[model samples]
Target: MNAGPISATAAATRAAARQLLRIVIVGHVDHGKSTLVGRLFHDTGSLPDGKFEAIRKMCERRGMPFEWAFLMDAMQAERDQGITIDTAQIWFKTEKRDYTIIDAPGHKEFLKNMITGAAQSDAAVLVIDATEGVQEQSRRHGYLLHLLGVRQIAVAVNKMDAVGYREDVFTKIEAEYRDYLASIGVTPTFVVPVSAREGDNIATRSQAMEWYDGPTVVGALDSFQLPATSVDRPLRFPIQDVYKFDDRRILAGRIESGRLHVGDELMFSPSNNTARVKSIEVWPEPSDSDARPNTVGAGQCIGITLDDQLFVERGEMASHTTNPPVETEVFRAKLFWLGRKPLEKGKIYKMKIGTGEAQVTVQEIEHVLDTTDLSSSTTSKVERNQVGEVVLRSRRMLALDEHTRNGRTGRFVLIDGYDIAGGGIISMEGYADQRQLVTQRAKNITRVQHGVPTDERERQNGHKGGVLWFTGLSGAGKSTLATKLERALFDRGYQTYVLDGDNIRFGLNANLGFSPEERAENIRRVGEVAALFSRAGLLTITAFISPYQSDRERARKAAGEHFHEVYIKADLGTCEERDPKGLYAKARTGEIKDFTGISAPYEAPDTAELIIDTSNLSIDQALEELLGYVEKTFRS
Candidate 1:
């Protein structure tokens, strides 16, 4: 593409054509969100011409104190407490772009304010405290922005003056925080040093910081080459309202991702819905045919008229014809559980994903991640504001995509009963539970199992095969109790089978080995067979050193509500002394891999009904108590 040398009139027209971009400043409390925004307005002269005088007069009238930040701190309590409680959208202009800057509050308690601001922004200026470095909420805000899919980031390391403007200090903090950002997958475009309160290196270049050399605050702002969404992505129009005025039913919404055009064939994924453009319009008419729809994307308000009445409601999306939308009920999500209570598994919660809302249950918690260090070498229940990957199954399906693939479909908010407590982004499309799909993929291969005549199995023992789970450390005497319990149940007219590790490995589980994942798979297989046994009405007793709580949880879920979970609790010292099989000795000597008793993760279950401590109780005593409970609970 070529253009002739610009005329003065054309250049002036080009300047006038620059659309205002919304930028939001967000960070933890006292981390410079307000001070930075205040400085920007001060530098841009966006405040009244007599700004301090205007503030002074306002304060004088109210008999209150005032500061430069008072220009935007319009709330009485905000001034009184010296903390922002809500997002403030203030308009200002630089030499190049007219801007709307959203100042987001950073207190951990005011995350809603942060979200409100982030929701409206095209880009973000992530503020970090230099002296304190990255705190919990600092990492949290970064993670939230990443979850919200905000791409461009400019990190402002505030309070440089506090640390004596050490370039090394700023450099170190910048590097550390930048590494943190990249872990959650964001690369901040720029890291600028400035003392927001003292105005050093903010609006004006500071000579006091002699070694530091980069764009001054104004320079960075003026030099930013704003990228348009039309050049980057496809058209996306989310229907926000359905309006009918003067017999015209118009679909009104913001062009959230890409440009809209007249006669464009659009498909809405979530509704399994599609539509073709009839007319593209704004309130005022445009002269150019190409600009008739005003050549817009990613922040323009327009009304779309369709060829057919699809009866689309608010929250549905409109995309290009070539790219069909996603329809999904379950997706793998990278979630930050922000509720006061830990994210419990199997409970239903409302998920507001993009424009789609559904009741979603946490199918599984994949891993719990540390926000500060980004370590995920462990898995557990997620606490408040703890980021993790959770697989969710929804009561109702909706259009969806992974966060890496599409920001809109990927983003979701978790609702706890009536409250919106957490939010996250779908990171992966969850696989259909493959066990259920196995036969279909295998040319509809029918499962052919030779039946052991139910009567013969009953003759071999007595009742049905059901799982009797025994959980404890390696040397906890679980096997002894399980052995006795199985014998007791066997004597009581039950078709009983014992699945101890040694017994299992010699036959059905011979192919399995030691590793957390392998052990989990082993437990899973055992649990499955136990269910089959239970279905045949045979009593099954299984004892394994399964260390992971997730594995145990899956075992319980797999085996059904009737499955018995017997926790054989024994102290390490007591178990070591009794080491019947000498397995704990081998494990301690490093002869075993992922040894539960020596080197592995353990998640103790909270609701295990029967806990028999063999350290205090002998094998007979534990078995007596367990069998007694089982008989009392299940025997008719």
Candidate 2:
């Protein structure tokens, strides 16, 4: 293919409108990643004037073979060491599209830089030495491609000339590497045999290897498909900053995914704040006669002004409320550890995801994978360069989606003091609000055990340590009976405390809401608090309308064996007719959503230590039966 000259204006216009694809070349060190990229650049005629000839002259003057790797090894240190130390990007164009070839360092010492380069790419080209077959870094980089969600990949079995360009040798290496890639859940698009230094099977097919036939490197790159983007998906604009220009406040950011338009309502996650897009603001102010675009889609950097002027800042995501991002403080992630120290449980570290930064702790190490063999290994802490699955607990809730659903929001990086220690993807969401305390046993945090045991405290207090958890629908007389039982236990000279649902909501659970998840969180918080009181050697009476059996079970687990689940039974009709707090009527009128026994589900306990028929039995009779069970259990 021959090329034609172009004016500066035409080139700029072509660059702006051309289909752009980011392609990163990765492999083991001294296996020709830089040479492959340099060869591609030279064959495509993408180099500037006299650049290639200048490198050849430099190589000749230094009494060395005129190597193609010199074009990409631009740094003095990399040239001195004869290795790629950092990721370098160069622009090239095929007949199909424009390309930014990212030459990633294959050396293990620069693995972090390689990760950064691969994360930014849309597709990847993995290189392997044909004679070496498959090295350690080959499997490691392939595993990382799977971890980072780079599905479009092509393998170039380079250095085939060293093995005499034999078809049998290429076939053996290709089969072995294919199996390794499949083990890590990656199916390469093309595995082409090539000698990058000799410029064979790169831009064009090599006549020397006539028996082996496949698309050249350039053909494989062009064959990779481009994904279409539209505004149909949920909006996820991570706020970069809030700019104030001449008294006008605008939120400035690049739409990572989805779309934004004038008058579209957006909800900022973690904060759960809502606002309307008043206008789509852009830079380099248009003339008075010029018209502006009404909407903007993904990858566009634009400033937007909200309908209501409020103090909205960075680190918050702009998303639609109908499809809001999941907000949680805990999630399961797979990360590549690059820290100098092993990642320890309960050790605090700063995590940066999108625009949000928070203190996070490695709560649990599920398992670590040996990247070379793709085998699972048990480890208490994740050492440097090892890929591990872990449970992380952030100090604040973050808005995120699973990587399979949204790559932009699902990814994060851990910063250790001054450097990026690790980077990973969120594979799954977890219950965060109060269930975190349940993992306290697995975390490495210290728990002070005093000289006085709970047995001694209970003996001195004249009662056994336990939590009596009352679960039922609203207006089921759970709170009333719990309070009455507390007084009876107190009068009997027993240590007891009552935790009412509404009372705790005003203090400990003030931030919680009526959503199903929030309600679960509410129950979780009360469960932990009740467990604390029980540990303090008190008979803790918790009266809550915890309608979910799963949540109730978690509460029981958090409170331990001393916890007893008591069902306060009352039919919805009977509770509605009572209307003690006017809650049922409001629930029926649709004034409140997710109201238990009405809008939402109410899961009754299958087995309870005690059941009170509050509908049939009077308040006094119910209190007497509950107090009877409590006294028998605690005072025994």
Candidate 3:
């Protein structure tokens, strides 16, 4: 008999069954993670025909007990070492859908491999030895999963047969692990007691655990829904490379998120250059009969030609102007350190984010996290295999997103010399997105030309006008140096004035708060006023913490050649020891929010005109050097 036509609902269900889900299985060493995956493949009849028999024969020839972990541990080194050293991926299926099971290594030495596996998975299965309950590695694995943004998790308490399948034992293990996972903001979907060796509670309900009423492992696996597709998110096409082919310049990259179509306007970030997509191109050009695709979504690797000949380069991110990625030089990060040496503050490392690379310094280490107990402590360094909250500063602006916003563009790795030292997720917790602040918004305003020429003013004053912008951490002696320098310049009959931070805030910027945006605006206003003073043939001295490099750059642009960046350098420990204003104490006591060198970030100048190290130099010595430099440069 011929079959009838399939209904729409049945056809949709069949299509859904073909969809693939990637799952990473992680746990402590010898916790049966590999065994669980092997058993799942066997129970579902998804293994190759002779694969199972070959494994049994090998075990018999070696005079060893038949083991399920051997099914996934395929490497000769793994078999000899009796441990999985790398991430093993295999395909398996149930009646409902297909799955890619990634068996991640659980040994502490191979945790980086596990992290790589978990990073590519949509869901996770955390295995635990029932006898061991929750080990330190178990808690560490759970925290790593959370850090990788794996929310859909199932905990399989293996080795139940070792404990005689006791209901209290299972309950105790489940309760302890559940509490630990909850502490790190991870609530597992289901906690099932399973004996992978005997196939209990793995593919079917276990008869031995009669008191247990939760779904089996297979049932829980089928219950997880796929995460939202990247195509639904905003467009983030980072230019990996630029290919010049004949007459066309093809911008090649994978669409990290969102969609791109022919004629769509693309705004390249960090550069802020715009262009229109002229045509989409693919390799092995289609025939005349085959219509070329006009649109492409996330995950597709394609190239496109633009309408204009723009100087686009590698490391530029393409996005819609309405929803561009956050442009910033400094951002907060939650880092997982894996380096042999501890990650220390003020140390420079190469950061790879998206397709771009930049040199970033560890501006501050907020705290080192104890993953096992979910406790945090203030620290100056993050040790190997530890996690910490850090603030990283880059010299140039980076186009990125917060991890919660877009995982693909939000993750990055730090390279120490040649090895991968750490990986982290970006967060703009206390930082501002500087896109709007940096972009020019004012329109149609004309500058009033001064009647007096600058040279004429210089002739009258016997010296050229200039700005000495002193920037550093609090207690770095910026105000002290600025006041003394002003007095010395006055004694020499040179016109000079000091614009201290407190004095400016008392009047011109009193309405502005200490928020990142307000701080940028405050510096902006002070920079303009200082520029006016310099234009009037007077040396202007401004003393402020002015933490962000971008703000300082703006001030330099406003003053042109007259701007001189003077870095009053002092180590944080020395500044705290001085604590001249008692502000550092207030910041430590939680009385001040967004305090630089305490809770906030302070980006030291990379190419300052002069650096005065107050930590080592006496007040008189620093002042003499400063006065000599000013006289030699500004005096005609």
Model 3 per-residue lDDT tens digits across residues 99-208: 77888989889988999999899999999999888899999999999998999999999999999999899888889999998888999999999999999999999999
Clashing pairs in 3: none
Q: What is the C-alpha lDDT of each candidate?
A: 0.72, 0.84, 0.90
lDDT of 1 by residue, 1-636 (tens): 112123546544643577557688888888877877777777657675566577789889989765667766778889888888988776667766766678888887888768767866778888888889878888878877886777787888899999998889988988888888888789887788888888887778887787878877666656655655432676667777898866667888877676676777887655555677887668675777467553556657788788888888877778886764455455677776768778877778987865557788787786887766777744547887677778777755466656666565557888886777777777533132222111122355676675776556645654444577888887787777777877888788766777887788888878977754456667778888887777676677788876655567667787786487878898778878977878777878888656665665445556787888878887678878987786776554
Superposed Cα deviation of residue 620, candidate 3 (Å): 14
Error of 3 at 59 (Å): 3.2
Q: What is the lDDT of residue 147 in candidate 3?
A: 93
TM-scores, all candidates, are 0.60, 0.71, 0.83
Query: How displaced is residue 39 in candidate 2, in Å?
Result: 1.4
lDDT (Cα, tens digit) per residue for candidate 2, span 1-636:
222234655555765788878798899988998898888888888777788899888888889888898887888798988988888877778889987788898878999999999988889999999988888899999999889989999999999999999989989888988999888888999999999999999998998899877899999999998754535567899898998888779899888889788899898877777789888888766675146668888877898888887667788888976787777767779999999998887688999888878999887787899989988977789999999998787767677877878888889999888988999999643333332323233446787887889878977988888999999988888988998888888988988999999999899999988776688878888888898889898889999989766578778887898899999999989999987999889988999876888866566787899999898999889988887887788884
Can you tell me which runs of candidate 2 are displaced by over 4 Å?
1-15, 230-232, 287-292, 429-636
Q: Measured by C-alpha RMSD in angstroms, how accurate is candidate 3?
A: 5.4
Best of the candidates, lDDT: 3
* TM-score, cand. 2 vs. native: 0.71
